[model samples]
Structures are given as structure tokens and as C-alpha cells.
Target: MLRLASSFLSVPSSLPHLLALLLALLAPAASAMELGIDRLESRGFDSLKGKRVGLITNQTGVNSAGRRTREILAKAKGVNLAALFTPEHGLDGKELAGKYVANRKDPVTGVTAHSLYGPTRKPTPEMLKGLDVLIYDMQDIGVRSYTYVSTMARCMEAAGECGLEFMVLDRPNPLGGLRVEGPPVEPQWISFVGQLPVPYVHGMTCGELARMLNDRKWMSAQCKLTVVKMQGWERPMVWRDTGLPWVQTSPNIPRADSPAYYVATGIVGSLAGLETGVGGPNPFEICAGKGVNPDSFSNTIKNLGLDGVQVRPYTAGGFSGCRLVIDPKAKGDLCVLALALLVETNRASKPDLFAKSPADKLDIFWKVYGSTTIRDQLRQGTSVQKIAQAWKPGVEKFREERKPYLFY
Candidate 1:
């Protein structure tokens, strides 16, 4: 047993100044992360002062004080807040992933809201006719499959087509802005979910991504783009380190840790054709499909020496499967859990969860993973380590290519 006082650094009361300094050092560190919206407000939202402004945001588009962006803009002095737009989730952030949300009026701001994820993904000429500028402020995970970036890309193109300006109030990339993973999407596999030819985990905020789209000509057309760079955000900080409240970006991602799990198991649920807690509070973390025994699976996985994650039998209310813990103790990539899960599950034989062949289901599976070859390799019983090795070259090339556009 260890004594509590053994590791203590003693303070000297005889040296009063030194004692005060020690106390200060022991205090919790304060965070100074001001969001882009907060900075925009401080500057008096000057860009929208005399313009007919159309805002594309959701419930996650709020400031540090938890005030909705449109509410503040609609009531701000000198700003002509015209209309509102929403993406895959409605303005409320209640809609499920891949489901189309119908356009509805916002009760708070009383603006005519259009559903961009519905009938027309890209804004129509009518939507842009009277607007001088389009401002977008949506919180997004730094993944290619998430539709928010795709929505922003379309809006930029539409604004350019109608001769209007577009601006993005940057948000933090929750996965941080350093690691780039997975395969670069081929042109033929491009869809609403994965439009840009980036990896599954492209580590850039919305503003940076918009700039890349314009510079790289990823969008159909280019607009006069402006990015409101976030103050006090660094490239190395994750969401928890930023000290801001975690607003649910979607019904599925209810907490901060959920996005990481989604990257690992969400696609597994989709390809396997199982219920991934769509309406429930917790999603993507549930291991309740046609699963093997919890104890056996967990022991085997733990013994495999998987990096950056631990698995244990989770049993509650007659349900049992392993909980894939993003093991904080391990000095390994946090994404290892996702990669290892795919590999382990692929090796084990179980009931066929896919109603059709994975090739037939590439339309859905390819959204997140962004490669038909990955699906085919899994089908062919290829090891996950081998697959990762094959993709390492592409991942390295992308990291260098995206360096010029880094904004944190």
C-alpha cells in the first residue's frame, strides 16, 4: 500500500509568496475557448449588417452561453435575418441519420425553414434569389460520411451559382485536427454522405473544409468564400479539453464519446443490418445484434492485445455482449477499437446478418468506409491488419496534401 503523503510536494509557510504560488498551481486550470459564433457576435456580426442573410444551422449551432445562433441573429441590431435552413436532422436535431426531414417553421425565430436534406439537397435558385449572403454554422464530427460537410459544400456551390457570398463560422473538429485515417473515396463512390475525396476521418473543421472544397474544386461551383476562424481553438485539443457543453448533434450521437464509437461500430450495425438504437438514448454502442457470448468474445478480444481499447462482458436485462471501451490507459490510437472490431468480427463465423451480399449492400456500407474493396476484402476473409497496411500509403499522401489547408 502507498502512503498518501509520500508523493506530496510540501509548501513552506515561511515563504508566503511561494506558498501562494503552490496553491495557484493546485487549482483547476480555466479554459479560454471562445467559439466562432461568440467571436462573430463580439465583432457585431458586421458581415450581415445590411445583407439579406440566410442561415444554415441546427440546434447544435449555439454559442458558449447556449443561445441559439438564429435567435441571436434574428434579434441582433443591424442584421436582416431572412430565412433558415436545416440539414439531415431538422432544426431541432431530432431526426435520425439517413432519414429525410421535412421542412418546418422554427417556433423560436419564426422563420420559414427549408429542408435541404429532403427533395432538394442543393439550394434552388428561388431559395437564393433574394439572399445576398449565406452563413453556415453547424457542429460536425471530422468524418467524411457525416452529411453536414456535404450540406455545406452544396450550399457553397448554390451560392456561387446564384452570385451570392458564403461564409462558415468554424466549429471544432471533435476528433481533433491531426490524425487522418481510412481510404480516400474514389470518384465513383461519391454520394451525399461522402462527396469529397477524403479519408473516413478527415481532421479539419467546417471552415477549413469549405476552403479546401473551393481551392480543390470539389464543389460543383465555387463561391466567394469566407471562414470565421475560431478564436482560442488549437489543432491538438479535443472537445472535452475545450470546456464547452456537448450539444447532441444528432439523436444517435447523444454524448461526446458517441462519435468515436460511431466511427467503430456504426457502420458495422449498418452493414450487418441490425437495430443500432435508432430511437433510444444510447446508440452505436449497443452490441445487441446476432452476437457471440459476452464473456468468451471479450476474453478473446482482450487476449488479442488490441491497442487503445479494452473489452469486457456487459450484461443487463438479459442482454449480453462486449462493451468496446475506448481504453484511456492504452497509449495507442483511439481508432484502434473501430479497426480491431471490424477485424475480429470478420474473422469469427456467425449467422449471416447481411440480407444480401456485402457487394449488393455497398450502397449503404460504402457511405462510412468509402471503399468497395474493403467490403469485398471482409467478404474474402482478409485480416484487418493487412487491410490497414494496404491503405497506409493513401493515408500518408492525404496527410501531406491537406497540410496547406489546416485551420485550428
Candidate 2:
């Protein structure tokens, strides 16, 4: 327990004041954190006021009071909410992954919502015609390959080219801020999924990433950036500690803690023949294949001595394997868990897991992993421990490089 207050000294002399103080001390401390949108509202939407704003967000962009940021901005006095933009999923987040979402008029605000996942991934000059600023407020899952951050980067480039200001309403990295894992994106593997040079599980908020991209000149052009920082959020605080409600970021990421599981299994899931509970009730929560023995898989994972995660025999979608229960508080590398699963799966059932995977699937795997080297190494019988050890240098370098941009 993190207590909000420790001691109350110099008590009020009056009886009523003293009683009220006692009541205040006796009441349970609130852990409610003010998000970027909440803070912006508290400031009377000053940055957005009198500005023609283009909001890049999805269903996840809501204030502390559960009010949509788009609606708030649309109705805010003197704020003209000119346009809307959505990332991989559509504005409502009902669209499936990798599916193209067509542009449509937002029924509520009547603003034309542009699909950044469709024919045009970046904002066109016509889309930026009358906008003064592009405000991004979507929740990111803290994985480099998730693509929302990539959309943000491209929008920043467009903002720079059009001379429009860019604003990011900061949100918490659900994986917290201390954990950096896996390899940085190699130059050749850079794509929409691996846009930034950050590691797979880079632990920074959207605002921090924006600042770093602009300052580092990672994007082609730099935009005038403004980050409306959150209030009462700490680096160690994960989603559960933030006291904010979880809006499903996408179709499969249906819970607040889903990001941890995604990091644990997303890369491995990219390979064909492995079922990661995508269609079932628990998406990205299970590692199972057609011929896997559940007991052996669970026991092997347990013997690996990975922290912050517990494994058990589980069956889902006619595939038998282990269900991962990750403890966000513990200091475990989720990507390492993915490697462990890959290694164990190869040892137990799929000896040809990598060798037999389809070329397209392998392509996706390498792109998501940020390099083809890891796959090649794994195929050549590299131990999971040694592979994880290899990631230390790059992860450490990123930890130092990201120091200047971290807000919390």
C-alpha cells in the first residue's frame, strides 16, 4: 500500500474543523488518476480552444468520467472538432485486425472519420486542409508491433509537412514503465508495425514516444508537438493501479491486462499451426497446438523459472497447451515467455515449427520480432536463455536513449 497521506499535524483548534479533519483522515484514499483528457478538460481545453482540431482516436479515447474525447471536444466552447481519424480498427473498435476500415461520417458528431488503415495510411494534404492541430488520444498496448504508435508517427510526419501542430493526450503504458524487453527494430525490418527503433516491449507512453521521435528525427519531418500530460500517474503504476476503466483497445485486446498476454504470445502466435486463443473466449492467453501435450508443456514452462508468470495445463479450441497468468507486479520479461514457449513447443511437439511455417507467416513473425535473426537463431538450435541474453545490449541502449523523453 501506497498511502496518500502519512501524518496530519497542527490540527484545527475548532471542534467542527477537527471532526471534519478526522473524517477526512478516516476515509479511504482514492487512487483515481486524472488522464490526459481529464487534465485537458480541467484546463478548459485551452490548447484546443479556437483551433480546428483533427482527433486521431478510437473507442479507447475517453476521459475519467467515461465521456468520449471526441464528444467533449466537439461540444467544447470555441473548439472546432474538424475531423476524426482511426488506426487499425475502425472508430468503434469492432473491426477485426488487418481489415480495412472505410471512411464514414461519425453519426454522433457528424465529423468525417478518416480510415488510416485503408487505402491511405497517412493523412493526405486534403485531409489536413483546414485543421490547425492533430490531437491523438488512443490507448496503446505498449508493444512495438501494435501499429497505433506507427499511425501516430506517420500523422506526425504529415503534421510537419503541413505545418500543423501535433498534440498527444498521454496515457499509461499498461505494461508499466520499468520493463524494456526484446530486440530493437533493425533497419531492414522496419515497417508500419516496426516503425520505431524501440524494442518490442518498449515501456513508454504515447507522448514520450512522440517527443523522442520528433527530437531524434526518426520520422522524416518533425512536427510542433504538445503533450497534455496525465496527473497522478507514476512510472511503476500499471493499468490496475491507475483506477481508470479499461476500454478495449481492439477486438482481441478486450481487457486492461490483455497487453501483458499479448506481449507474451503475440510473436509466437504469428507462426501458423499454433493456436493462441484468438477466436475463443481468452484471446492471446493460451499457447496450444494440435499435437501438444498440455501437462508436459505446463511443467516445462514452470521449470524454466520465469518470474511474474504462472502456467497451467489448459485446453482451448481443440488445442492443448498452457494458459499464462501473468503478474504485472513481478519483474518478468513477457517476450522471454514467448521465447520459452517457442523453445518448448519445438522440443515437445513441433520440431519443425520454424522450418515448416509458411513463408508469409515467417515474414510476419520476423517483422513482428523486429528481425529475422531471432528466427534464424532459434531454427539453428539457439537456447532461449542465450537469445534473451543477446537482447540485453540493445535493450540497455534503448533504456539510456529513452531517458530524456520519459514523462514519469
Candidate 3:
């Protein structure tokens, strides 16, 4: 077990080149990739055998074969599934965002399921009682401020405080692992949305982030940590490349490709008076606002020459703008695309979008964007290119700092 842990920690410095070569060699068998849950099951639940386990999961926590991890562990021969925990949207993934979910008995497993999104965000010592290990298994959209990763980090801290083992069942970052973008969270602005000090589009998986959090002492305490890594997943492979089924991560993120769109326009949506297709068919896929002409907006975005993205005029409800068609494989910074959209909206709208926005909304905007710098730059007429350049140092620093934590 010590040897296995050491091997997981010792990443070779030439990992990038080696990983590219490995991907080329394993192209044919890419579809045969096994998720962390699948690998854990195949190992006969060795790490969890005869242990009382608590699971932090939602609808996205499923094996590649479509079995829920909660159900799997409940019936595993020697594994005693003691408790269950739900994050933002609740266990069923149907609860509305930010709505409090109460603790209840899980209808399927009859386990006492706790709510991490309720009055208390972290599990208390009483909640950790009788549990030997806490396992985390949820699919994240690969963007910061999504809150699931925050819940994971808070849970890790709780587990550490309780001196319990914390295990992460690794999953692939749907946006791929090479596309790190946006600024790191500043110390003063860290909140539930931006818990970790990583980029807005930090491309590492939940397991990698967990390892970084543990090793860097980002958490209050260090727990005995283990990550059941996936088999055949590589850094360059996006969701489609993995051949895994897509489960709706949340209400807005209803598809595998939804994360890319989220990155493109989520920041813009945080401000007032713009609709990013929240209630429409294409959530987070369009940038629209009142009094804006769809053709002009679409043409403006198209003319930006942003790689990996195509734009078309789209009108929905009372708003009109462009529907973004994002190609995740191509070289493009989604964060820059968001900034451009904001700038264009400010120019097209009657009053400045940033100036007219309420203070609370602007606070949410800064929180999601990781700083007040971009908002200030936009209000002062700083171009998106200049803003990107200014934050480039922080993003580049994060890219280099994150190399050792990456598993693929």
C-alpha cells in the first residue's frame, strides 16, 4: 500500500511527452477506459472492505456501466455503507441551485443522508461518527466556482479534522486537462464559489485538485488520502474522446459539452440584464440582452477571430445575441471569449452593463471571475486582450504550479 501511494505521488518530469506518446499508442482502446468507480469495483473494494463508509455524491456519481456508487457500495459484500451526503443540487440532482436541502433517509438505500448544502456546509464531528472513511465521487465541469469541488474541499477538511480517511474516485475533466485559463482566486475574495486558489478554468480533475489541496496544506488539516485513479484516461481526451456516457451534472449543465459553453459565457451571465439562456433550450450556450440586435452581436463575436469557436445569430424570449458553438479541442481561451462578450454588451446596450448592475450582482460577478480587476478594466474601457495579458502571469504561474499534481 505504501509502494502504491508512492507511485501515485512520483510523477516523472517528462510526463507530458510520455503521456502524448501513450495516448497515440492507446488511441484504439480509448473507449475501453475504466472510470475510478469501475476500477475500485474491479479491485474488490479492497480499500473499503469491512469499513464503514460515507459517500459524498450526487446523480453524476455513477459507474461507467450506469450503476450508482451508493447502490454499489450498499450491496458490496464486506463494505458497510453507513451514510450518504449530497452537495448543491441534492442527491437526486433536481433541487434548484442555492435552495437548502434537508437531511433525510435515502429512499433507495435507507441510509441517513446528510445535506452539505444546508445550514452547515461541512460535516460536523457528530456526522462523522462511526465512519471509517469518507469517499467523494462526483463529476465536476472543470471550472472553478462550480461549488462541487468546493464541497469536496470542505469535506476533506472535515475528514481531516475527524482523523478519518478520505478517498477520491477520480473522473475526467470534461474540458480536457490542457486548457487551464482565467485568474487564480485572490485570498480576500475566496468564498464557497471560489474556494481553492486555482484558475477559474483550472483543468485538473477532482482527484488531482484533492491531492494538491492536501500536499499544499490548503486545507485546515491533512487526512489520510487515497485516489482511485482512472484507467486509460489521458490529458488530451475530452468527454467525447473518453467514450463514457454523459450524465447531467446540474440543471444548467445538461450535456457533456455544456461545460465548454459555461466557460464561454458564465461570467457574463453573472452580471445583470444579460441572459445566457438560463431558462431556454441552450443553457449557457448563448449571450443575449435586451435591445441588442442578434445579427450585429453574432457578427461582432465572429469577427473576433477567436479560435475553437463559431457564432450565429440567436434570439430567445425578449433577448437577442449570438449562440456560441464551441470546439473544445481547438486552441482557444474561453475566459477571453467571455470578456469579449461583456465588452461588446457594454458597447451595444443603452447604459453600461457594469455601471448599471446592482452592487450585489457585481459582487457575484467578481466572485465568479476571481477578482475585481476584470470588472474594473471593463468599466475603464480596457480591451479584452489587455485584460488577458495582465492576468496571463497568474494563469501561467498556475499552469506551471499545477504540473506536479496532474495524474494524466
Candidate 4:
């Protein structure tokens, strides 16, 4: 027994290597992706030493190993995690959009959980008491209209007001950092959804946005902000490429395919022009409603000669609508696909024939879009090519402006 123990202690590193090699040969290739939480845990939570942490996250905050961010924090070496804060969705992320989630106690950690989407959308001074740092870690769907961005901005403002050190555990944009689309929002039209004057698909991660927000002084005060960047990520890689797990960002936007098509479909859905499969199994993946002939619509979009994607008559769950099937591996510009559909749609579409959702439901898609120029251009029958050319300058300027804030 003494000799066996001695052999094990001496070959500790070799034994793990042999085991890993055997497992690698037996199983399929696993992703080598490392998320922000992965780096934080592996490197030891030195930055959080003796600090009472308050996390603003949800079910989406998980490492590549499927460990919850809150659980990782609760068990970290030096972490004094004191509170939990949830954004638009509740702690469990089951609450519907625009619904209020009240403050509750976390059964796992017993920490007080504050609902940022309840009566107030931002954290108040009372919520920050006794917490030394506020940590944010949630996967953003890569759209400006998503409430996560607004929640982050509001928290930044609160951190400034209450003198709290804030840090963000950066996640991949999921939409990647390239491919930006849509018109820059007008200042007056800005709201919680369009927190900043950015294009619809800003193509930025939450960490980059946090840095830009601080540098632009969008926050009330200049709070000490630290963004824990991802180690193995780059600008060109999307979520699927990263090999990280996907949690539904929202009820409608479930898998990666949903967000990839959301910005494009949102252009029509916001105007009450069409229904984009909200209550179905494939939400945000199908566009159908009154006046839509799937076969005709599919042929028209295909005739437009869009690259990297195709249109097809998609029928599922007793509904017949068209889906813009994007090849995940295709390197074509996704932003253009939506524009092509819109342009082709106007040629034969009666915008007046579009159906509208009930008022009680969360129906401010037009407000979420926040671009009168695009809407008016589409309404007046502008060519898709001409409309695409118009927004080139703004997108270029935004890309240049955000360069200094980019980490990966």
C-alpha cells in the first residue's frame, strides 16, 4: 500500500494525461472554448478577495462545463457573494417579457434576489448596501433591443450613484462582432430598449459595450469598471463556433438560429406587418400571417439573389410560413438577407393588410426598431440596394468608434 501511494503521488501529472488521452480517443472531439467564468474560476478569485459580491445574472450565466455562475461564485475560494440580481426575466428566467418579477430569496444560496425588471428597472441604493462589487455575467443575444443591454446600462448608472466597484464577465456576442445592420437610432427616440444610438445588430459583446458606456459617460458617475475578457475567443467566431452551450435568451429567441434571424424578421414584425412565429415551436424563425403566400414569397426572395441564405415554404405545427434558412457555416452577410426580403416583400405586399397583435401583449416592435428612416424608405418603395448603401457610413463610423473598447 505504501509503495502504491508513492507511485501515484510521483505520477500525478502523467496519470491525468493518460486518462485524458484515452477519453479523447473514445469520445468525439470536445470544444476547447473557455468562457469568462471559466477563466475567473481557474485563475483564482483574487480580484474578489474579501469583497461582498452582488451578481446581476440569470440562467444564461453558465460556464462551458455547465456550472452556474452563482454556484461558481458561492463556492469560489475567496468570494463573499452576498446578493443576486436578475434582469428582465426573473431569477429562473421563466417570466414573460414586460412582466414584473418581484424580489425573492434564492433557494440554493439563500441570498436576496432583486428584480431589476419590477417596479424599477435599475438597482436602487438600498440594493447595493454592503456589497463591494457588482458582477454582471449573462449571454447577450447580440441585439440592442434585447433588455439585457438596458439592464446592464441601468446597473452601471446605479453603481456610479452608490459607489460600487462593477465588473463584467464578458461572453461571446453570439451574433459575433462583424455583420452590423439597421439604421442608427435618433436621440429623441431612445428608450430602455434602444439604450444607445446603435444599429439594430450592433455586433458587440456586453464587455465592449460596458467599456464604451463608461468612456462615453452614459453612466451617472465614473465607477471603477473591470471586464474579465475571454481567453480563447476572437472577433470572427459566432456562438456555434465557440462550442459553448446555448440557453434560451428569451422565450421567443430560443436557439442560436432564432437570434440569427430575429433582426431581419423584427423589421417586419415591429411594424405589425407579420407574425414571426412567437407562440410556436420555432419562434422568431418563421414569418407568416395574412396575405402571405409561402410558395410565392419563397420564390420572390430567392429571385432577389441573396447570398449565404435561402428562403423556403416552412410549415410546422399547423402553420405555413416562410423561414429564412441561414447556413451557419456560410460566410455570407446575414444583414443583407433581411433587407432583400423586405424589398421583395414591398413589391407585392399590401402593408395595410398586415395584422397587429393585441395591445395588452408586449407589442412595441416599431419602438424597439427605432428607425423612422428605414421605415419610411420601405414604405416609399426604395430599392433594397439603395437602402443598403445609405447606412454604410454610419456602420463604418460605429465600427471605428468601438475599436478602442474591443477586447478579443
Candidate 5:
């Protein structure tokens, strides 16, 4: 028995070697592929074995190989995938923007799909009563006011109330993780759109944000949490780096450039007469308000010497709206791009540009871009760079405070 035990400890690791070889054989051949829940197959569903799971996901919650979480978990070994929950876009992502979802069975999987939007923006006790775990896997646009994160936070609270474990199967932030920009939301004015004082473009993954919210007690403090971290993802690589295909998480964000332009031009979504390219090829890429001075705005940015971006002015016609396309060929820094455009807009247009309401634009800016510095700068003729720099201290402080929660 002693000799057998010695042999077992010394030269008898065939099982491990075989497992390693098998994994190597199964190793992905390509880079930047969609690294979603499908990767969890070999990682095992043992944590959820025999437990009913409620999944909150949307059309973008797909594996690199193009499989949905619902389909994957339904067939996953030992996982009793019970219920399906959806955010703004509905379970299949067919609903149009602002369209409320009603509880219904998934026509494809026959699983009960609950709407976490509309009059009730959270999961109720009935939804959690039979579930052992609640999993979230939506693609976020990297903006604070995008609503997906809010849904995640609300669900976290609901899961905690029912003693259910919450799991975040993270995907990339789409805008990448290196560039944290914009101002932090003020806590006093916190709304459903802006919870937890995160920036408009917080450079952390959804999983990291989930942990931060829990740590900050922005959500319930006692919720059980687990995050499935992404492998091979680094901060420098944007969605383009992930080699993952772009899935439009919302109607307006048609492409990766939409968020790129979002930092600079999306605030224009709040200005009136600007069509905002909602139905066009590039949503945030196009901005137009009635009586917008396209030539002056263009010349203003040209003189800013802001490195890395060029905006070409054009008219979208009556419904198309006069707009600017963020020149795809240009490249440099994002904030510089934003500052240049903002300074130019303020110089070329009236304070009325900022004063316009929903008839003129969307509802995102009054909340996300409500920085006192920027507002005062526009009011006092301060340069956009100066305005942006004024907010940098706050941004730096947030970055330092948020470091502990970063997974990468």
C-alpha cells in the first residue's frame, strides 16, 4: 500500500495530462472571438448544478461562436436553466426602443421570459422564488446612462432580497477598458439613468462595475456574487480587438463607431432639431439642430489643434438633419475629439443649443453630461479643453478609487 501510494504521488498523473492534452486540442485557433458563456462549458456549470437559473440577457448576449445563452444553458450539463429575463430590447431583441415588454414564453425555447423593463423595472419575488441563481449577460455600451447597467443593479437588489446568488457573465465594455472619460454623476441628482456616480464612459467591464456597485453598496450589500472573467482580454483592445462580431445592443448604436462618436456627439442627442442619426446609418455619428452653423462649427474645431479627429459637416436634409460624420480615417485621443467638438459647437451655436429639450434631441445628456464645468464653460466662453481639464481632477480621483475593482 505504501509503494502504491508512492507510485500514485510520483509517476501516475495520466488523468491530468490527458485533460491538459484535451484542452489544448480544444483550444481556440483564432483571437478576439466572442468569449461568452459558451466558454463556460468546459469550465463547468457545477455551481448551478440542479439549481434553477434565471438569465437576464438580450440579443447581444451571444457566444463568440454565435450561440445564445438560453440555447447554451438549456443543453448544458447539470444546469437546470429555468427562467429567462430580458431588458429593454426584449428576450429576442425584436422590440423597438422604449417599447415595454410583457411576460411571455420564448417562442423558440418555451422558457418563461420576464420583462425587467416597463412599469416594473425589476424581478419580483415570484420570479426568484424557484431560482437558485440569477445570471446577467447583456452587452453594455460603456455609457453610464445606457439603462442596461441600471437593470443589472436593480436585478442585483431583487436577487439579494430573495437570497439568490447573482452571476455576471461579463463581456467587453465595447469602448475598451483603457480610456475612462467624462464626469462622474452627482449622487444628489441620481436618477434611474444615473446611479452610483459612475462616469458617462467608465472604463471598466460590466463584471467590474457589478463588484464596484456591490462594494460601494450601491446595490444591496449582502448579495452573493460571482463573475466569469474573460480570458486574453487586455485594456488596450477595443471591441475591434476582441475579434468579436458587433451585435447592436440598441437600435441607435448601429456600430462600434457609434460609441466612439457618442463621447463627443452623443450629448448632441439632447439638443433639439438634431436628428441624431437614429434611423440613419450612423446614429451618434450625425448631429444636427435647427439653425446649426455647420461651417462655423467645422472651422472652430479646425482651429482647436485637437489631435486625432476630423469632423466633416453635411446636411441630412429635412428629416435627415444637418450633421457631422466622425471621419473614420482619423485617429488619436477620444477626449481631445470630444473637447474639440464641444468647444466648436459652443462657439458656432447659441446657448440655445444646450437649452433645447426632447423635441430637439434625446434624454441622455441632462443626466450624463450635466457637468457644472462644461455648462459654465459654455456659458462663459471657456475653451472645451479648459472645460474638460477642469473635470479631469474628478476623473482621476474616480480612476484611483475604482482601481481595486478592475479585473484586468
Candidate 6:
């Protein structure tokens, strides 16, 4: 597949470079990726010395060595670590999705922890008071609706508002960087969920996104923004190649494949008003919903002969509710599966129901797909192939537009 045997060209005969590379190449599966901040010596954490900093992160902010960032920064020479700000999942990563987290003292560091996901999902002028710079170093699930991207955007805006500097310690997008899928969100439908026009699966890392956001008008002109880029990462390398650990960014994303399936089945679950199995052992693996026939729906999709994925039946109840099967192979084609599922389900269900009145449960979905094309196509009984064909030009155009921003 993506063999890199050429990595040995730089090695000297006396050195064990090839051996090391071979060992790495042969490394056991599930080894974690070494992220940007993990290479602290190269990235220069010392630049943060003497700065009264407020950090925006959650459990995924651990150092490569598994130490917490606040702990490391506090012990480092000259760092005046003052406060901590948490995102959607809260500081400890224990809070349920969308739950409010209030300000409290971190039991270990005693740093005042502020909740960015509570009443305000952004740092207010008061929140940024006395802070020299606001540093963001969280793992993003790489989806437009994941909320971490929006959190970073708000932090950048607040930095501008209060004349504070914003630094983004980037991390991989988990879904890899080969392609940016789905449609760019319409600015009018922008919410805390999504504040920009980026596609559903933006292939760039957090640092690259910060650079793009720094040029946008939504940010305060006065704020100085900087991104510490990831080393040895390229646009084509997915999370599997990163040689680092997996830390769950959100409660539902328990594994790397979760985000991959999220791009596809997640959309289907949400649009159909079904249980996405977020809280289960395999979040995206479950695709059941209320009033849905899991077997029939699964058969319909299987009969469509869609490439690169399979729909398996499943059932959920008690809080999760009813559902359908899953596409375990749905790694790179989440949006494709989303469109396919929508198109197929409509043909088997009552005709034109979605066309008469499309579901508007989450504006974020509509924003990304660009004008409800998936739902509209389904309602009109359009074939899955036709709808996918229609999205080709838009997907290609978006991939081209995001070329400059690509980072592995």
C-alpha cells in the first residue's frame, strides 16, 4: 500500500537507522501516534515560560509521556500557569455530551478551571483578563460538528477581544488528510457547532485550521495567533501511521475507527432521528433508530451494492432507543455512506415524505451537506448513484480549495 522503504536512503552504514525504521515499520498494531506537543524539545515548550497562560483542553491534552499538560507546564522552568479552560467534555473528560461544566479548582494543580462549554462556549473578555496568552492543545475528532473546532474559534475571537495571544498546539484530524469531504457550511447556518465554511471532514490538523482562522473576519484583529505545527506529519498520513497513543477526545469516540464511521453512519443516525450508539462500547457501530426496521433497511442497502461499505443490523433500547445495522468498513467514505443510506431508505419508506418536509433537527447537518441535497435526493426517489454523482464536482472543488491547508 503506502510503503516507505525509501526511508533508509538517509541512513549511514554504521548506523542502525534502517533497523530502527524496520522495527517501526514492523511495530505492533494499535501503537499511539506521536503528536506535535509530544515532541516538546523540537516544538519548544520553553517559549511559554514566564507567560500567565490559560489552557483550553480536556483529557486528550496529556503529554506524550502520559503526564497532564498542566502538571508538566507547572513544573517547567518559568511557566506561570494560572488557569485552565475546558471544552465540551470538561477537564476530567467525565461529563456527558453537551453538559454544562462550571468553574472550579483543579485538585492537583489548584489552577482555577473555567468551563468553556457551559453558559458560554467561548472565553469572554473577563475570562481572558490577566492572561498573557491562551494556549489550546486538545485532540479533535476532525468532524465539523465535533465542537472542538468551534471552541478553538471562540478562543481565538476572545483572544482578539481581550488583546491576548492565542497559540494552537496542533494534533492529527484522526480521519487522515488524503481528502476533505462533504460540503462547506453556509455561513448563515453557522452556530457554536460550526462557525465557518469548512467542509464536514476538514483534512487539516488543528494548527493548520488556526492559521486559516487567523485570517478570517470572525476573529478579533488585535489578537496575535500562532500555531506550533506537527513535525514529520504529512498530508497523506492517517492516525494509523502516527506512532502515538489513542486518547479518547470525547466520550463516544472510544476508538480511531469511531471518527471514520462518524463521517458516514453518524450522519445517517442523526438525520433519521435514530440512536447513533455514542454511549455504547462501539459508538458508530450501532445504527438503529425509532420505528425503523433494521433488517429491512440493512437488506436494502446491501442490495444497492454500494462500494467500500456494508450495513449490518443492530438493536438499541432503554436510553439509546431503537436502531439499525452498521458499516464496519466505513472508514474513508462516511459522507458517501450517509448519502447512500438516505437515498436507499427513502425508496423503501413512504415516498416523498422527506421531500415534503425535510428534517431540520440539527442545522449543523444541513449546513455541511449544503442545501439538503442528500435529503432532497432521497425524497425525490433519486438513485444513490445519481446523488453521489452529483456530489463529485463539489467534493473535487472542495478538495482543490483545501490543498494549501493540507497537513498529515
Which predicted model would earn the best TM-score? 2
Q: How well does candidate 4 match the true structure in TM-score terms?
A: 0.87
TM-score of 3: 0.91
What would the per-residue lDDT of candidate 5 be over residues 33-108, giving only the tens digit for each residue?
A: 4354755664787677888889998788888777787888888878888998889878766676668988888876
Q: Residue 302 deviation, candidate 3, in Å? A: 1.3
Please tell me which model should have the higher TM-score, number 1 or number 6.
1
Instruction: Give the C-alpha miss distance for residue 113 in model 2, angstroms.
Output: 0.2
Q: Which ten residues in a row have the lowest lDDT in candidate 4?
A: 353-362
RMSD (Å) per prediction: 4.9, 4.4, 10.2, 6.7, 8.9, 6.5
**Could you tally the backbone clashes for each prediction?**
0, 0, 0, 0, 7, 18
The best-first sequence of candidates by TM-score reads 2, 3, 1, 4, 5, 6
TM-score of each: 0.88, 0.92, 0.91, 0.87, 0.84, 0.82
lDDT of each: 0.77, 0.89, 0.89, 0.78, 0.73, 0.69
Per-residue C-alpha lDDT of model 3 across residues 153-221, encoded as one tens digit per residue = 999999999999999999999999988888678888888889999988988999999999999998788
Which stretches of candidate 6 lie above 4 Å from their native place? 1-34, 41-44, 218-222, 271-273, 290-296, 303-308, 315-332, 346-375
Could you give the candidate ranking by lDDT, starting with the highest? Answer: 3, 2, 4, 1, 5, 6
Q: Candidate 1 lDDT, tens digit per residue, 344-364?
A: 554443644433336645476
Tell me model 4's lDDT, rounded to 2 decimals.
0.78
Better of 1 and 5 by TM-score: 1
lDDT for model 3 comes to 0.89
Q: In candidate 1, which residue pairs clash? A: none
Which residue pairs in model 2 clash with each other? none
